[model samples]
Target: MIEIFTDGASSGNPGPGGYGAILKAGSHYKELSGGFRKTTNNRMELLAVIKALEAIKKPNQTITIYSDSKYIIDAIEKKWVYGWIKKGFKDKKNKDLWLQLMEYFKLHQIRLVWVKGHAGHPENERCDELAVAAAKQPALPADLFFEAEAAREKLF
Candidate 1:
């Protein structure tokens, strides 16, 4: 079984944001993170899980993901994202991320466990630190989908 831990941080809600994830299976361990110049906390939250899933080299693995985001946890575990997909994701946030995540669902058996943030869980705290550090880095890339959606929203 693989254990994955994840967290996300934003300096200003929709401002500089980043995600962090750690994957461990037996003796193998790896960390992943990236930052966006402009994005929401929710986007980072979702992306952390996606990035971690993408990191796994083999398909059909058993994985348990620990996350601080109820936005990601409840959506999948409660089947709300499935309903959103049926509606073609109208009026929903992070549709692009949700779509990307579902492909991994077909590839692996994933279980989501939500951990309370800032409660001193060692792995969770480290992920939070990594997320915060990544968000603070200079010249972060744009979260293109988020930017495009925000632009389109302002035109209406």
Candidate 2:
């Protein structure tokens, strides 16, 4: 089975944000991260899982994901996402990422483990460092969905 540890960070609720993921399988490992000029921590958290799942090359892999975001773990574990899907994710915040994640979900058997943040778990800590560092980088790309939503909010 492949194991993935993920973390996301944002400078503000809707500020520079990033996600980090570490994918491990036996002796092999890969790290992934990216920054957005404006995003929410929840989006970053979901994106980290999406990025890790996308990195997998094989089909129908058995995957275990470790994340600190209850926003994700609970949504799936409690089957809330299924209801959201039926309702077309109406009034949802991270619909873009959630849709992407659901697509990836069809390709793998995924299990999510929730870990406490800032609890000194090595892999989780490393992911946090990577995420925070990426968020601090210059010239980060704008998060399109976030910008569009903000613009709509301003208009309405």
Candidate 3:
């Protein structure tokens, strides 16, 4: 069985953002993080889980992902994403990350559990710390999709 904890943070809405994730399986453990120069918190939230799932090397393993973002957890657990897909994700956000996650769903038995953030949960707090630190780092990579979407919206 694999256990994962994830968190995401942004300096501000549509600002610098990052994701942090911890993956553990038996005696092995790993931490992953990535920062984007500009992005939304929701995107980062979903991306954290994606990064964690990507870190798993074995397929068909049981995996549990813990996260605090309702935007990520509720959407999946409540089966809203599937409905969004059925509608071709028209008028929905984070379609890219959601699609990527759906692909991984085919590879593992995944469960998402929501935890209260900053509520004394060690792993959750650590992931949040990692996310915040990454978001504050200089020379972060651009979130091209977010940037392009922002630019187009600016054109109107």
Candidate 4:
């Protein structure tokens, strides 16, 4: 089984943002993070999960994800995302990331467990540190997050 802990950080609601992910499999572990020029916390949260799933090399692996975002965990755990997908994601935000997530999710057996942020979970704490550091880094590039935001705007 693979375990992933993720966190997202933003300097401002629509300001510089980043996500951090820690993947553990047996005795091996990997840390991943990246910053965006402008984005939101929710987008960063979803992106963290996306990046972690993308990093997984093995197919059909049993994976457990720990996240602090109710926006993410509730959507999946409560089957709201499935309803959104069924309706073609109309009037919804982050459809692109959601679609991407569904694709990756289908490739692996995955479960999401929500954890309280800043509650001192070791991996979660490290993820927060990585996210904050990445957001503070200089010269970070723009992410597809803004593109998704633009697409949502066009729908309105």
**Pick by TM-score: which candidate is best?**
1
Stretches of candidate 1 off by over 4 Å are none
Candidate number with the higher lDDT (1 or 4): 1
lDDT of 2 by residue, 133-154 (tens): 9999999999998899899989
* lDDT (C-alpha) at residue 28 in model 3: 85
Ranking by TM-score: 1, 2, 3, 4
User: Where does model 3 exceed 4 Å of error?
Assistant: none
Any residue pairs clashing in model 1, and if so which?
A: none
lDDT of 3 by residue, 1-156 (tens): 899999999998989999999988899889899899999999999899999998887789899999999988888889999999999999897788899999999999998899999999999999999999999999999998889888977899
TM-score each candidate.
0.98, 0.98, 0.97, 0.92
lDDT of 3: 0.92
Q: Give per-residue lDDT, candidate 3, residue 143.
A: 93
Q: TM-score of model 1 relative to the true fold?
A: 0.98
Query: Is candidate 1 or 3 superior in lDDT?
Result: 1
Candidate 4: where are CA atoms >4 Å away? 145-148, 151-156
| Stretch of 10 with least lDDT, candidate 3 | 145-154
Clashing pairs in 2: none
